[model samples]
Target chain A: MKFSFPKKVMAAALCVAAFAGSAQAAEKVYRLKMAETWQSNFPIFGDTPRNMAAMAEKMSNGRLKITIDSANKHKAAFGVFDMVRSGQYDMGHSASYYWKGKVPNTLYFTTMPFGMTAPEQYAWFYHGGGQELMDKVYNKFNLMSFPGGNTGNQMGGWFQKEINSLEDLKGLKMRIPGFAGEVLAELGAKPTNIAPGELYTALERRTIDALEWVGPSLDLRMGFHQIAPYYYTGWHEPGTELQFLVNKRTWDRLPEDLQEILRVAMRTAAYDMYIQSYHASAENLEKMLTEYPNVQVKDFPADVIKAMQDANSKLLAEKAAADPLAKEILDSQAEYMKKARHWTDVSDKAYLNNFNAE
Target chain B: MKFSFPKKVMAAALCVAAFAGSAQAAEKVYRLKMAETWQSNFPIFGDTPRNMAAMAEKMSNGRLKITIDSANKHKAAFGVFDMVRSGQYDMGHSASYYWKGKVPNTLYFTTMPFGMTAPEQYAWFYHGGGQELMDKVYNKFNLMSFPGGNTGNQMGGWFQKEINSLEDLKGLKMRIPGFAGEVLAELGAKPTNIAPGELYTALERRTIDALEWVGPSLDLRMGFHQIAPYYYTGWHEPGTELQFLVNKRTWDRLPEDLQEILRVAMRTAAYDMYIQSYHASAENLEKMLTEYPNVQVKDFPADVIKAMQDANSKLLAEKAAADPLAKEILDSQAEYMKKARHWTDVSDKAYLNNFNAE
Candidate 1:
C-alpha cells in the first residue's frame, strides 16, 4: 500500500511536469536587438523605432522585447544594412537610398525625385506591387525591407539666390544628396554632401550656396530661416519614405505570432510617423511664419524646373540600361505612378484647386 | 508512513490542479461580436472591421476573437450605435455622421464641407485635440469611437447635367446626405437621402437630378457612369472617415494587453484602408475613362462653388451659435486646418503644380 501511494504521487508529478513544460514553451519570451541610423533623441526619425518597439511589446503581452541601439551607440549610421544583413543586429531603421552605392537597386524603394506623393506612394507599396519589387531586391541580400515612415513633400532647398533659369544652376555649389545630387550635377551644378552639423556653417560661409534639409518638420529647428532668405519649394524627394530592415534569419526564428505583431507595429508606426511629420510641419511652419516672416517660399521657375526634369529623366534612363532589374523596377514604378497621379489630379488636386479659389 | 504517502499524493494532485487553473486563465479566449453598417460582402467598408479583427486575433495568438455581423444579418444598418451602446453588440463599424441625429455632436467627427483632406485630418485627429473632442461626444453614449477608415476625397456626386451658375441649382433635386444636404437646401435645391439600393432607380426615373456617391473606388462598381454623363469634383465630405465603436463595458472587461492589441489593430486597419481606397480609385478610374470615353469629369463653376461655400459658412455659423461645445469644436478645426493647409500649400500643392508643368 505504501509503494502504491508513492507510485501514484510520482505519476501525478510527472504529468504535471509535462503540462508545465508546454506552458513554459507557450510563455517563452523573445529578445531582439535593433540598430537605427539616427542619433538618440532625434525627433521624428528616432521616434519611429521606439514607437514600433513599444507597440510590439504591449500587443504581444511582453512576449516580444526589442532593444534599440542608435547611431551613437552603434557608431554605424550608414552601416545599418551590413549590420542587419550579417546578423550583428536583427533589424535596422534607415533610408533605402543610403545603400545605393552597395546595391544600386535599393534607390528605387525610397522616394524617387519627382515621384508620387505620400498617399500615392503608400498605395503603390501596399497594393500596386511596389512591395513585391522591393522584396525582389532585398531578398538577394538576406534581408526584408518595409516602408518605415514618410516625410511629406520636402522643401526644394534654401537657396541664397533665386533660380531664374538653367543658367543660374551653372557652377552653383549645393548640398544635396542621393540621386537628386546626381541630377543637379548633370545640369552643370557642383553638388556636394556635407555633414549635418556642418550644413549651417557651410551655407553661412558660402562653402555651399544652397542646402536642402527636410521640410518645416525638421528645418525650423535647424534655424535655417535665419541664414537663407529664399526657401524654394520641392522638386526632388516629394514623399521621402524611410525603410525598416530585418535579417532573414532573425525573422525566420520568430514564432508566427511575434512576426505578425512586429509587422503590424512597424506598419502602424510608419503611418503614425507620417501624420506626426505632417503635424510638426504645420506647427513649425506656423511658428516660422509668425516669428520670421522673411522666409521666402518660392517655386523654381518653370524653365529651371523643366531643366531639372530632363536631367532626372536622362539619369534614370542610364541606370535602367545598365541593369535588367533596375529597368524592371523603374518600369513598374512609372506604370503605377501614371495611374495613381491621374487619380490624384482628379481627386485631391482638383479639390485643392477649387478650395483655393474660395 | 502509510498516511504520509497518501498525504503527499493528495498534495501533488492539488498543486497540479492549481497550476493547470492558472494556465487555462492565461489562455482564456475572448470572443467578441461586431455589428457593421455595411451589408455582407460590402467592399472597402466591410473589409475594414474584418481586417482589424484578424490582426487582433493573430497578434494576441488567438486569445482575442471577433465575429462580425453585417447589416443584412443584423437587419439594422442604422442601429449600429444603439446596438453597441446598449451592449447588444460588443462593437460596431459605421460612420459617426449616421448617429448625428441622435447625438448632434457626432456630426463633426466625420468630414466637414470645405474641411481638411485625409492626411491633414489624420494629423488633426492624432496630434491636435480632435480625438479628445471625439471622446467627449462618444463617452456620453457609453461607447468608444475610433477612425474606422477613410474614403480619400468623395466625388461631388454624379450629375446628369453640368452646374454652371446658381440658377442651375434652383429647385434642383439632388441626393446628398448630412450637413452637405442642409447647405444645398439653402440654395433653393431639394436635397434628399435615398437608400443605396434605390439610388440608381431614383436617378434613372428622374426622381433625382443628381446624386453623389463615393469616388471612383466604389462608383465604378455601381455603374454610375452609364447613367450620369457629368461627374463633378468634391467639396463636401473631402475626407469622409468612417467610425469604429466599442462598448465601454466590453472595453473595460478586456485585459491590458488585449486592449492594446485591439487598439493597434484598428489603427493599422484604418491606415491600410486609406491606401486600399487610393489603389482602388486609381485602378477603377483608369477603367472608367477607358471604357466610357463619353463620360465627362467636371468641376462646378466658380459662381456655383462660391455660392455653395457661402451657404456652408452660414449653416456652420448657426451651429456654432447654438451650443458652446459646437463652437469649441468648430473653432478648433478652423484653427488646425488653417495651419495645416498653409503647409499643404507650400509642400504638396507646390510640388504637384510644378510636376504638372512638366
Candidate 2:
C-alpha cells in the first residue's frame, strides 16, 4: 500500500508538469507591423509615432508587438491611406488632409481655415455625434480608422512672393490641398496639388510659388527656409487632424482583445505626437530665426484672408449643391462650429485673447 | 451629309463622358472602431483622443472613419491591452504603464521617476535605437504600438500624509504601478494595485492611503481632494506615457495607401494629445484649488524623495539582475539618459528651475 501511494504521487506530479509544458506551448504571440507617415526625426512626425509603437510593446508584455516602419523604409507620406486600405500591410499612419483628393468632404472633418479650436473640436466629436458622422464617411474606404491626433491650428503656407493683396493671389500656383485649397481659389490663388516629396523641387524650381505644409518643426526639416523667404502665419488649416487607419479585413480578423489594444496604443501615440510637435514647432521656429536670418515669418494680409473667407462661403454653398456627401459633412461642421464657437467665446479663446503669451 | 458630321461629333463627346463616369466612384470610405480608455469628456484623456478621431475623419474626406468608443462602454482601462492583443477589436487606447505584468521591459518606454523627459524619450526611441528594441519586444506580444500621448513629467501623486521623513513611508499603502511600485517597495511602502474607478473608494475607505495618478488635472477629475487633503507630488512617475496598440494580423493587412493615412494620423494624434493634456492639467489644477478650499497640495519631503531615489537605484539593479528583458530596457534607458542628462542639466532643468511660473 505504501509503495502504491508513492507511485501515485509520482504519476500526479508528472501529469502536472506535462500540463504546464503544454500550457506554455499553447501561448501565442501576435506580431503587428505599423507604418508611420512622418520622417525619422521630425519632432511631431517621427518621435510621436515611434513613441506610440513603444507604448504598445510595453502594454502588451511581449504578447502583442508593434513595429513602426519609418519614412523611406515605407512609402512616402501620401502613400499611408492607400496602403492601409488595400490590406497590403496592417496598421497605418497619416493625416486626413492628405486624402482630400479622394474624399473631398473629409476636409471638414480635418482642419479648416479658422475652424474650431482643440476643445471645441473635442466636444463636437465626442458628444455632438460628429464622430458617428465621420465614421459614416469612412465606411466606404474599406478600412477602419481612429482619430489619433491634431496640430492645434497651423501656420499658413510659405510664400515666395509677398501676398499684399487679393490680386496677388490670382494665378498664383500654391501647394495647398483640401478645403483650404478651395478657399484659396476663391481668393484667386491657384491651389495646386503637390506631395511632400515633390514640394521642395516644386518650390525651388518655382513650379509652385508657395507651399503650406505644417508648422516650423516639420517645415524646418523640409528645408522650407532655404527656398521660401516669406513664411506667413494666420493658419488657414487650423487644428489639423490625423488618424490611424487599419484594414477592415485585418481588423475584423483579430479577436476582440487585440482590437482594444490597437485603439489604446494609437491614442497614446496621438497624444504624444501633439505635445512633442508643439514643443518642436516652438523650438524649430526659434531656430529658424536665429539659425537662418534670411527667413521672414510674416502675417497674412487681412484683406486676402477676408477675400478667402468670402470664397469659402461661396464654395461651401456650391459643394452643398453638388455633392450630398459634401453637404452632410459641411452641415455637421457648421453645427459643430456654432456650438464650439459659443463655448470658446466663453472659455478657450477668451483666455487666449485676454492672457498675454509671455 | 453636314448633319451627319455634327451628329458624329456629339456622339464622340457622349462616349468620352460615359467612360469618365465609369471611373468616377472614387475609393469607398473606411470605418474602424477606437475603444476609449476614459470618459468622453475626461479632460486630457477624453477630449484629445476624441479630437484625434475627428481629425482623421475630417482629413480623410470621409474615406476613412473611426468610431470612438469611450472607456468602459467598450472595455475598462486595464482591459484595453488584451482587447487589442487578441484582435477582439482593431484599435485601443491606454497608457504603457498599465501593462507591467506582461512586458516589464516596456516600463522604460513609458514613464519612470527622474528618467528621460518627453524630448529625451523621443530621442532615445528614434535616434538611440530604442524604438527598434521596443518594436522587437512588442512583436512578441502580437501587436504594434504608437505613443498615444504624454503627461509632461507628471505631478507627484496625491498623498494625505505629510512625508517629512523616509520612516513615514514604512507600511504606507500607495496606489502605484510599474517600476515605481517596485521602488516604493524598496523604500518600505506597500504598493497597491487599484483601478481608476476604485481609486476614490480605496482612498476614501483608507484601503489605500496614497495614490499617484497622471497629474493634477486627472486628480481633480477623481476629486481626490475630498478624500486626501494633503496631495503630494510624485517624482517617480515623471512623464507618464500612454499608448495606442494594434493587433498584428490586422496591421499587416492594410494596403500601402491607407497605411499612409493611419501612420500620419497616429503621429498627429500623439502630438496633439500631449500639449492639450498639459494645458488641461494646468487649468484643471488651478480650477480645483479655487473650487475646493479644503484641499492641500504639497511636494514630497526632501528626505522622503531622497529615500525614493535610493530605492529606485536598488530596484533597478535587482530588475537588471533578474530579467534580461528588464536589464536590456534599463541598460538602453541608462545609455540614453547618460547622453541626454547633460542637456537636461543645462536646458530643461535650468529653464524650469530658474524660470518664473508666474
Candidate 3:
C-alpha cells in the first residue's frame, strides 16, 4: 500500500521546497500519528516508538499530534513493519534488528552484536553516507526513517549460570534478537525474541536460560537484577540504535514547514535523550548495587569477545554473498570505518588514553 | 585569594567509602588554573570541565596537569552578594541585578540605545566589558573579570513612541547601558552614567534617549528591551545570566582538578560560543515562524509603558527603610543614578522620546 501523506505533494521536491518556504507562513497546526512497538502500560525505558511519540507531541505545541499504538494492540510484535509499509500508520518506531527478515541490510542499522560502536555508528549514518544507503532501502517500502535513539553499549544478558566457555553457549535458550541471534545460533544457542513485558515472565518460568536487555537504567527499571543474579557486561550489541519510521506517503504529505519542524524536533530530542540517559545511568548504576547486592555482575571474558568478533565477520561474508543490497551497505560501512577509525584514534581514544585513568 | 572549594561530604555511601580515610595517599598532580564559572564548559554541549581536562591529562599519563579557577578571578561583577556569602570563588560570573548598587541599579545591569544588540554585546563584552568594567569596577580596586556570555533580547527598545506619548518618559534616561545611547536619547534625549567605554561615547555621540539591559536571563540583559520597546515582558530577565570577577590571591593556589578543568574547559570559546544559541534562535525560531508567524514581535510604545513606574521612590524608600546592608547598597545605587538622571532622563528626554514616532 502506498503510504499517503495527506498534506501536500507526494514527491520529494515538494518536501525540499517546503523547508525553504517555511519561514513565511500563517499559524497552522499539524497532527502526527504513530504506531509504537512498546505496548501501553508496559513500563520500559527508552521504548523507542513511545518516546518518539511522547517527545514530538510535547515539543510541537499540541498542534502536531501523534497517536501511538503499541505492538500488542496492533497485531503481533513483528507485524509493525508490514503495517507501516502498507500505510496503515503514518510512522512505526521499533528496532530495525527485529525486522531483519523484511530488510536484511537493517541489521547494521540496529545492533550486530560486535558491530560498530555508538559514536562511530552515528558518525557514519549522519555524515559518512550510511543514511543515504538506508534511505535507499526504505524508499522501496515507502518508509522514511530517522535514528530515534540509542542504548549506548549495552550489558551482556543475565544468565542462570556463569558462562565458562563457548561450550556453554551450546543449546542455551536465550532471548536474543535479529542478526545477533543468528550468530549465537551458529554457536549452537537457540535464540528467541520475546516482548519486554513477557521477558521477565519467561525468565521466571525458566523458559529461557539467559536474556539481554539494555544498560543499568532500563535494567533497574525492569527489575531484571532481582530475578537473575548472574549479570554480565560486554554486550555484543554496543550502541544499539532504534528507528523512527515515518510512512513515506504520510511524510511526503507534510507541508515543507511541518516537515522541517518535525525533523529538527526529532534531532533535538535525540541529543537531549542521550544526556538524560547518561544521568539516568549514573544514578541507576548506584541504585542497582545497593538494592540488589546478591546480583553478581561480571565482565565478559576477552576470549568470548574474540569468538563473537570472528563469527561476525563470517556472518557478514555469508550475507554479502546472498544479498547484493546487504553487500552494498556492508561495503560502504567498511570504507567509512576505515577512515573513521584513524580519525577517532587520534581524537577520542587519544584523549581517553590520557585522562580516564589513575 | 586562593578560591577554595568549600569541602562538602559526598551524599553517596559508596563514594564516601571509596575516598574516605585515604586523604594522604590521594594522587596529587601539580595544581593548575581554572578561569571561570561552574558548569560553564563541561556539563553541556561541549566537553565537561572535569572530563575534558581529565581526559586531556589522562591521555598524557599524568605527564601534564591542569587546574580550574571557579568563582575566584577578581572582584565580582555587579554585586556578587552570594559569592562572598558562600566564599565560592575568588572570582565569579556576575550580573548587575546582584549588586545593582555601588552603581545605580538600572545603569549597573541594563544596556543602552541602538547599541549592543546580542551579537554586538558579545563582541563588546569580550573587548569592551573587558577593558571598561574591569578597569572601572574591578581593577579600580585590583580585581579582574571577563565576559562570560550574553543573550540577545533587545526590542527597537520598548518605547513611549508607540504610546503616541513620548512625554510619559519625559526627562527620564531610564538607566540604559551598553550601546542603547543614541536611540534612547535621540527623540528628545540625553545619555548618562555611560562607562568610560560607554559613558564618553554616549555623551559625545548623543545617543540613547534612554536605555536598559538584560531581563529574564538576567535582569540586566532585559532592561534595555523593556524600556524602549515598551514591551514589558518580564521574560527580559528570563535568560540574561552572566559570570564575573575573581580575586587574584585565591585563584593562584587552587589545585589542578578544580581550576583549569572546571573553568577554562567549562566555557565554550568566544567564536564558537553561540552554537547552541544559534540553534535555538535560528533553527527553532525559523521553524516556529512557519507555524506561528503571528507571534507578536513588536516593541513597546513610549507613554503606555514609559510612565513613572515610580522606579526611584521605590528604590530609595525600600533601601532606606531596610537593613544597614540594604541602605548602603541602595544609597550607592541612588547616588550614581542621581547624577546620571540630571543629564539623562531630565535633560535627554527633552529631545528624544518626547518627539519620537513620525
Candidate 4:
C-alpha cells in the first residue's frame, strides 16, 4: 500500500538523515601513500616516516591513514622527490641534498659542510627564516619540504690512517657524496660515490681509502669500526637532517584537523629521531670501544681542518655567486649561524670545557 | 487521518534517531582548564602552554579545548601541583623544581646544577629512564608530568663585580633559588630568593650583588646588561626544562584519540620552545651587545668553577644517600649523561672547536 508521512514528520526524518550523512562524512577515512628512500626495516632512517605516519593515524582516530612504500617496494631510493612531486606518492621521506642535481637549492635544506649544529639549524628553520627560504625553493616545484630527522653530528669518516696534515688528504680516495665530496675534490682528494651496499667492501678491500657514513647510530651495523682503525670526528654534514616531502596538492586537500595532526606528527618525529640518534650513537660508541679496543677516535689536525674549511668556503662562495636564491639562503644561514654559534660557544661549549677541566 | 500499517517506516525512523544520537556522542567536546605558574603574557613561559593548547585544539578538531589561567588569575603561583592534584584544575604548566619543597624528588626533572644540556637531557628523558622516573614520582600524587618546554642554557647571572675566586663568593648575597642556591650556599655564598618584580631593583640598587634570571631570551627586557657590567656564562641550569602536569582523572577521561593528540602537541610545543628560546637568545644577545657595548661576557675562573663543582657534587651525594628514589633518578641521569656527554664531546663540541679554530 502506498503511504506517505505528514509534512512535519517528513521534515524531521530528512533532518535526521542529513545529520547522519554529515557525521559519516566527518568519519570518512583518508588513505595516503608515502614513498621512503630507505629500504624496509632500515634502522633510524626508515623508522622516521613510519613513526610520523603512525602518530598521524593514531591522532586522527583512523580517519587519516598513511601507508609507506620503502625503496624495496618502490625500487627508487633517490626518486622520492620526483615521486612525491609528481603525486605518484602523497609524500616522501628522504634527504633534501639527494635532489641537488635536479634542484641545486635543495642542498642547503639538509645539513651543509661546516654549518650550524642541530639546535642551531632548528632555530634557523623554525624562527630564523630557514623554513621560509626552504618554502621559496620547494614551492616552485609543487613540493613542501620539511626537516624529517637528524643524525646529530655525523662522523667525518672511517679513516684507515689518521689524517694528520693536508698532505695526507691530497691523494685520498673516499666514498663521500654530495657537496661534501665536491669540497674534498677541491682539496685534491679523489672523492667518489660508491653504493651503500658496497661501502664496507670498498673500504676494506682498499677500493676506497676512507668513507664517511653516518655516525655511530647507523655506522656500527656496517662494521666500519672493525675494518677502519681511525674513526675521525665530524666535519662535513655536522647535523645531517633528513627531509620530508609532501606534494603541494596533497597537502592542500587535507582537512584542517588532519593537517595539524600531520604537521605536529612530523615535527615530533624529527625531534625524536635526533634524540634517538643521540642515544644510539652513545650506546653504540660504548659498545665499539668495549668490543673493539683498537678503534681510535681522532680529530682532523688543525691544518687539515683549516684546508677543508677554506675549500668549503670557496665552494659556497661560488654557489652563492652563481644563484641569487643560493646567495640569499647562504647569507641567511651564515648570519643565523654566526649569532647562534656565538651563543653556543658561550653556553654549551664553555660549560662543557669548564666542567670537563674540573 | 491516523497513520496505519506503517510499522516499517517507524522502525526506519527509530534507526535514524539512534544513528544521530551516537554521532552526537562521538562529537562531544572535552573542556580542560590549565593553571600556569607564570603571569599572563610571560614571554616564552606563557607562550608554551598556549601553543600546546592551540595545537591540541586544532588537531582534535575543537573536540579538545584547554583554557589556561595564568598566575595572575589563579593567584597561586606555586599552587599548580596541588590544584591539578586535587582536580581543581585539569592541567598545570610550571617548573618541576618549583614543587621540590612539596615533593623533593621533583627537583631532578628540571635542570640540575651541573647537568646535561638540552639535547643530552632530552635523550635521557625519552630514550633513557628520566620519563619513567618522572612518571613514578608524579603517579603517586595522581598526576602525570611531561616535559613542557626548555629555556636552553640559562645564564649564570648578571654580576656587579666579577667573581674570579672562591673567596669572592663568600658573603655574596645572590638571588638564585632551588638546588643551585643550596649548592652555592654550601660554598659560603648567601643565596636568597627575591620576588621577580623586585629583582631588577634589588640588583640595580646593590641590594643583591648578583642575580641569575633566565638567559638573553628573557633577560633583555630586564635591562640587566645596562645595570650589571659582567654577564657571566651558564653553569647552573644548563637546560632548564619546564613541566606539564595533568590530573590523572583528567587524562583518564580523554578518549584515546584526544590523548594522542594532546601527547604529540605537548611534545612538539616543548621542542618548539627550545628553538624559540635559542632564536630569541641569539637575537637578544646581539642586541644587548650592540646597545650595551660595555656588557662583558665572562666565564667563571677555573679554580672557582672547580670549587663550585665540588660543592655541587657533595650536595648531590648527600641527597642520593638520603633517598633511594633520588639515588635511582640521579644515578640514571649520571650514567646516561656519561655516555651522552661522551658523544656530545666528540660530536658537537669537537666540530665547533675545530671549525672555529679554522
Each candidate's clash count:
1, 157, 139, 0
Computed on C-alpha atoms, the DockQ of candidate 4 is: 0.69
**Leading candidate by DockQ:** 1
- Candidate 1 scores a C-alpha RMSD against the true structure in Å of 1.7
lDDT of 4 by residue, A148-194 (tens): 99999999989887787788888899999888999999888999999
* Residue B153, model 2, lDDT: 56
- Chain B alone, TM-score, model 2: 0.84
lDDT of 4 by residue, B1-358 (tens): 3454356456567666756665665578999999999999999999999999999999988899999999999999999999999999999999999998999999999999889999999999999989999999999999999999999999999999989898999999999988899989988999999999999999999999999999999999988988999999888999999999999999999989899999999999999999999999999999999999989999999988888889999989999999999999999999999999999999999998888787
Q: Cα RMSDs of all predictions?
A: 1.7, 18.6, 28.9, 1.8
Mind giving the per-residue lDDT tens digits that candidate 2 earns over B1-358? 5775565556555544433332122234566766767866677766655666665555343555777778658747568778878877678777776777776776666777767666567656655667687787788889787777666556557777777787888999998876788888987899988977899988888898788877665667788877777755446655556777777776676544345546656655665565565455545665776787777656566566667777788878898999887788888788766655443332223222221121
Model 3: what is its DockQ? 0.01
Taking chain A of model 1 alone, its TM-score versus the true chain A equals 0.96
What TM-score, computed on C-alpha atoms, does each candidate reach? 0.97, 0.50, 0.48, 0.97
lDDT of 4 at B55: 97
User: Per-residue lDDT of A1-358 in model 2, one digit per residue for the tens?
Assistant: 5775565556556544543443232224667676778766655656555666665544333445767786678856678878777766677777776776787766566666656654456545655566787787777888676666766546677889998887888999999876778788776678988767889999999999998887775788888888788877644665666777777887787544345546656765665555455445645666777778987766556666666666777877897999998788778777766644432332222222222121
Question: Which candidate order results from sorting by DockQ in descending order?
Answer: 1, 4, 2, 3
Docking quality category of candidate 3 according to DockQ thresholds: incorrect
In candidate 4, what fraction of native interface contacts survive? Answer: 0.76
- What is candidate 3's lDDT per residue for B1-358, written digit by digit as tens? 1222121122233233433322212233444433433333322212223433453354222423545544334333333434533344344444444444443332333332212223223323332232354335544444445444434332222333333456644565544543233334444445455542363234223354433432222222222332333323211221242444445555455443334323332232211122233222322323433444443333334332332223334444664685554455344434433332221221112112211211
Docking class of 2: incorrect
Q: Fnat of the models, one by one?
A: 0.77, 0.01, 0.00, 0.76
